[model samples]
Target: MEEKVGQLAQIAGVPYESEQSEITGPVAEMGIPRKLLPIAGSVLGVSGAETVKRIQDNYLKENRLGIPLIFMVDVIHGFKTIFPIPLAIGASWDTDLAEESARIAAKEAAVSGVHVTFSPMVDLVRDPRWGRVMETTGEDKYLNERFAESFVRGYQNNNDYSDPYAIAACVKHFAGYGAPEGGRDYNTVDMSERQLREHYLSGYKAGIDEGAELVMTSFNTVDGIPATANKWLLDDVLRKEWGFDGVIITDWASLGETIPHGVAANEKEAAQKGIDATVDMEMMTFTYSNHLEELVEEGSVDEEQVDQAVLRILKLKNKLGLFENPYRTASVSDEGSIVFSEENRQKALEVAENSMVLLKNEQNTLPLVPNEEKIALIGPFGTDENLLGAWSWRGEPNTASQVLESMRKVVNEDNLLYSKGSNIEEITTEQLEEAVQTAEKADTIVLALGEHWEMSGEAASRTNIKLPDAQLQLIKRLSELKKPIVTVLFNGRPLDLNGIEEYSDAILEAWFPGTEGGEAVTNILFGKANPSGKLPMSFPENVGQVPIYYNRFNTGRPYESAPNDKYVSKYLDSSNYPKYDFGYGLSYSDFELSPVQLSKNEMTPGDEITASVTVTNKGERAGKEVVQLYIRDLVGEVVRPLKELKGFKKIHLEAGESEEVTFTVTEDMLRYYHPDQTFRSDAGEFEVFINNSSHTSHTETIVLTNK
Candidate 1:
């Protein structure tokens, strides 16, 4: 029983020594006995088939029950052949692409001896100031929910545990981690229960419903209770309400963080609170290993509680077939061929091409003709290899293609020019002069700019979310040349483009597109691939509009944009609208959405109303369009959002071709969490809008009457 309890706690990865060293040194540092090292359930941040096999072989010799250690890693984007980050995938608005990316990541990680991946971070994010927004699917609840299900399915592969390519998926930062105060990471998150249920909890629930094997507690406090020990969230909602029986794990060292959160006095009390909340595992924390047994002995926590947690861990291990083969899918033979395979590289390329958002293309500045016009590629990122964003631990930057190398394939050597205008943060007068000299010889300029890859991940928050001043200065100098300029961005978050936007004729938001990033960008620039991705999150005109999103509630006195209007919810210096609204994207081909048509005016219980629209390609080039559907409740017990995305479809069309897109609106779609906390739909008037983006003005209304 003591061994079982010990298995519920995990320790940091032990150093790999050619000659086996005594475990006492490492184990003692974690405040645990040397004997518990073998019984400890799992290890984090360790990979490689040969090393994993050696560690398991040595641990089994000392383990009394021969239970194997589970190897876990943060394979967030990919293992070796990196793909676009989660936020980029969300911009694609293609659930199939999101799922396929996860499948490829799982296959690569499994071959490298990873048993579990802490990924598919389904936190609903609206604030771009949070550095970790780059890790989420973005602001809308419905969109986040759909991507959540796709990611879970991709990692698990229909829950076939014995498949060598499959790895256990752990959905993370459970419950309101994305709504931290002041857009800071690990900050307190306080909101009404109604607000939490309505906006933030849908994505987590979608992942859980799609059969994710584990749930990770968030770092921030939900209400007054830290998520690591919040009983109402973990026990009442996750376990009892959602009927989730999967293992619950804490984020790295989150269990011990209860002390800093002022919830527990010491490690013993933290472990007790964590177990009482039904958390199955503590990652990289001494709370459980140092005090769980003592708590059980003193009857401060029930013995049965420890037993249940242990059983869940055992079940997960057994499900992975670890008992029969501790090194279940680890293979030195497969590692060479599977990790960063050519097939995987091609998949990464396809996703990167689709994930880029075309924010602007004035005067048809893109789709540049090859060899006809002299092209100058200017910036630090022009030949840089740091395209893979943060959280790519195993991804090799050397494998990524540089922009100059990729453009060389399509353009003649004599016609294509290049220059490193400046570093990502600093610019020299000499460097600016050299860049202008290069631009003077070229007919057009491709100015690559954005935040460094490290500027927007965990602990990488910035108060000012804009391009470096140096980059903007370079843009201003090049704009003075009176030559066509197209800006390609390499950022992780939505950047404020107040100054840069006016100078560039066209702008492409190519978020840290991974591995084959350069090749993907080249395809779009040369007209081989059309840009189709939309903004998953809003782009604020300025940093002051930090938490701006499309689904916000209308103020009592809404700003009417009239000359005489005053004293409303309007900023003195800026407008409430975003610089570029969510779901806004441009392609080579223009698309027009017809007025939304409804099957009927009224709906009843168990009856569905079909909302249909026709999308026509109005341009000469073939392209794709994302038809979006939004709903608004005229009246409710609690105020509702002005507009909420309910459904969307991405369709490809030939030039001048038209297609009909339909969405079935059922009673379940209209339901909301009432004041009494029950999920139900109220009898009221509803408004529906079918358009290309969230800022569309066309709409139709419907009514829902009592059965």
Candidate 2:
């Protein structure tokens, strides 16, 4: 029983030479004895085939049962060949691209001896101040659900983990971690059970439905109960209700955090609560290892529970084929060949290209003529390598191409000029002067601007999401030149562009484009690749308008923008609408959507209705467009969102081409969690909208009758 208990606890990496390294801080801090190392179920933050093999070889010598250690890492977006951040992937609205990125990530990480990846963080985020928003798919439940399934499929490869390139998919931050109050990370999440089931739980359910092998509990509390110890959430809702038989793991040091949350008195109590909650694994914490056995002996916890947890661990190892071959996919030779291969780099480039959102293109200032215009590339990020964003575990920033390098390929050497206009957060007179001189000599200005790479990710929340004062000042100076200014923003989350919008002729939200970020931006600038990405999360005009989204519920007195009306729900000084709505993006080619057409006006149980629209390319070039389908429950037992994204299709067409897009709405698509906690669809009037973006007004109404 003691050995089995040890298998439920995971530890951080211990160095090859313990006396020469401080890598054992987690071990010593947690008071974990050296003897427990062999029985520990897994290790965190350890990678590379040779290093993993050596650690496993040494642990086997002290093994009582000879169970090999499973290695896990935060391979969120990519392991070696980096791709765009998850928010950017959501903007692409391309499930196939999302899945392909995950497949390439799994392939690269598997050769380096990684068994599981803590990725596809399907948290539906609305607040841009939360730095971890970069890790989420965005505010829409339906879009998050689609990307969730795509990521799981990409990582697991249809549940066939026996293949050398496959790795276990761990969907993370389960149950309302994205809705922290005041947009702070690890803060309290206070919401009704109805809101929880209606919005937050959709993505996790989608990933589980797609066969993700593991679920990681969030750090925040849900409905006043800490998630790691919330039996109602982990067991009743996730395991029993959802029929998820896979293993449940706590976030880093989350098991021990139960005491800080005031739920448990000590480590023993925390361990008992976690086990009772059906958490099969404790990560980076010794609470389970130190107290599980004592809890079992004192009748605080069942011995069978310990056995059950260990059995799940062993079964996972068996499913991963780790028992038969400890070094299942670890090959030092294959690691060099597979990690960042040419083909994989190409995939990264494609994703980066498609993930860029063209926010504004005034007077068609882009697709610059190569020899006719002298280009001035200015800003701190012009040559910076922090384009990989956050959680790129194995990605090397220096290997990525720079914007200057890519631009030099298409533009004449004599026609291109460059200068560092300002640092990410600070500006100097001398730097501004040099940038102004460069812009004055050029016919067009390509201003690269954004937050530093460290500004977003875990533990990196911000109070004001806007262009840094220094960068905005530099933009003001460059705008004085009266030249065509095309701003390429390399940011993690949506920023307030209210100040910079007026000065720039074009704006491109190039998110921290991964390894090929430079090439991708250049491709869009030179018309090699058209930008089709949309805003997954809305861009507020100001930070005060955060938590802003297009699908918000209608109020008793919704804002009508009536002249001299102050009683409505709106800000005194600002409009309620966002600067840019969700699903809003522009391509080089124009797209027009005809009014929606419905096959039938009424639907019954098990009946399906088809909503069709004709999309036409109304410009002089070939491009891709994302046709979004949204639904609104006009009348329901409970208040519902004004519009919920239900379906979308990315289609390509040449100039003067048109295509008809049809979406089938079934009874399942209308189902929602009722106020009484039952999942069912109510018979009522529903409105369907077919539009190029969320702000479109084209709609058709349909009725549902109970039969």
Off by over 4 Å in 2: 15-27, 561-563
Estimate the overall C-alpha local distance difference test score of candidate 2: 0.90
lDDT of 1 by residue, 245-325 (tens): 889999988999999999999989999899999999998787887788888888898888988899899999999999999
Least lDDT summed over 10 consecutive residues: which range in candidate 2? 15-24
Candidate 2 per-residue lDDT, tens place, 1-707, comes to: 77898789787776432531243665476566665676888888888999889888877776788899899899988999999999999899999999999999999899999999998899888999999999998999999999999999999998897678889999989889999999899999999998998899999999999999999999999989999999999999999999998889999989899999999999888998999999999997788888888888899888988888899889999999988999889989999998999899999999999999999999999878787979999999899998999778689999887899899999888999999999999999999999999999999999999989889999989998988899999999888878999999998998989668999999999998999999999999989999999999999999998889988988887886463678878998887999989999999998998989999999997899999999999999999999999999987788888898999999999998999999999888888888898889989888999998999788989989997
How do the predictions measure up, each by TM-score?
A: 0.98, 0.98
Q: Candidate 2, 123: how far from true, in Å? A: 0.8
Q: TM-score of the candidate numbered 1?
A: 0.98
What clash count goes with each model?
0, 0
